[model samples]
Target: MQRRRLLKLGIGAAVIIGVAGAGIALIKPGLVDGKLGPGAREVMRAAAQAVLSDLLPSGAARDAALQAQLARLDATIAGFPAATRKELSDALGLLGTAAGRYALVGLSIAWAQASTQDVQQALDAMRLSSSNTRQQVYHALRDLNVIAFFTEPANWQAAGYPGQREIP
Candidate 1:
């Protein structure tokens, strides 16, 4: 009887915590109309610059390309399933917070204010973190940036991927 009562209490507590967590996540201000909100966008832009710095040439060209790629990323994220989108938004929200930024990226400042090297260091730390969730966030952000960058026809040459070959 004791074991059964304890099991029931544990299950009830788990359900309550899960419901509260979901409620808090839904009320977070980092998402706008089921899309990447401003805070998320800022984090992603900084992350993109840090992750793709080597491939991006300097000056107006790089700026233009980054802007276009960010747009593509935004569109792609907008189409993600609700759960996936919520996870991403939550991650972004955490990174946007100063305490979470320091914990994850080793920076106490906002991502926009952090230098590229600092952002890179943070991302590297996340990639190497013991936490699987941190690693997942790092990989997901990097993958999105890479896919958006490499899929452009202009970048195909750089990646040595010839435009779609016409099979006779």
Candidate 2:
């Protein structure tokens, strides 16, 4: 009976450790890579275009700025807490899926294929959505995009902020 009880206890301990390991793996999925997958990156690019359209110029300049901004965004995401990273990862993954895209953004087309106007409309709807989840997702993307856009020194001039005053 003593040997049987010890074996049962060992099995239970192994099960607990297995479950915890799986949970941690789920929470940190791909975070160590420090970059978004292609589909996720496309979604973020479309989102940035939609959110910062007024600030972003048309043509090659806009594309160049967007690439820099995405790099900044990726760096920012890489430093986020595990829970925040997980949430953002989950949201991005959902945005990449056709069904999730339609459900969340009301668009049948893939995010990369969606027109600027269409992407803007979808983001606007999300911003004004009654659902808390939708609004949260909108806010997260919007905040990231705005931060990435305004943090660039080139944009500071446009925003009317002179270079930092040197402290003597």
Candidate 3:
């Protein structure tokens, strides 16, 4: 009876190990542990849309719109599984940095293109902004350029941007 009990215990341990290994293999393709789980990408998309909405000219209407958009995103993401929700939340935090910088770049670009004194003043003021602010603005501009590159095939072709070219 003792021998039989020992054999059952060994079989149970082997089954547990095999299940664990299979689970890891299936869930972690490419060993990327921080992969955005199901539904997480959708949250990121919502966040991006919110940022784009917020970039509209600042005013009471815009403020209200931004708040409404954020609320919508929050509600939509609230139903995701905890692990996926956490991943989306973390990605959103990183995206916030990029969004701030993007906003700065958009503003800076607008200022640079303006022919009016008010816009020139705003641009000049932005030029004198703190180092951190400047970095955010510049980085955002770079990210925009990159995003735009991939967004349109024509734009990519016009720029002669080869996404992946094999070398000899």
Best by TM-score: 1
* Predicted structure 3, TM vs. truth: 0.27
Question: Candidate 2, after superposition: displacement of residue 97 in Å?
Answer: 0.5
Error of 3 at 11 (Å): 41
lDDT of 3 at 133: 54
Of the candidates shown, which would achieve the greatest lDDT relative to the real structure? 2
Q: Residue 62 of candidate 1: its Cα lDDT? A: 83
Candidate 2 off by > 4 Å:
1-32, 166-168
Flag clash pairs in model 3. Answer: none
Ten-residue region with minimum lDDT total, candidate 1: 21-30
- Residues 1-168 of candidate 3: C-alpha lDDT, one tens digit per residue: 699999999899867754653444354321123433333332233323333432433567655543444344445445557776554444333323323213332333222233334333433444567756544533433343245334544434535676657888
- Identify the superior model by TM-score, candidate 2 or candidate 3: 2
The best-first sequence of candidates by TM-score reads 1, 2, 3
Candidate 1 stretches with Cα past 4 Å from truth are: 1-27
Per-residue lDDT tens digits for candidate 2, residues 1-168, read: 699999999899867754654454455333336677676788889989888888877889988988988898888888789778876776676666665677667778788788889988988999899988778878887898888777677787766789789999
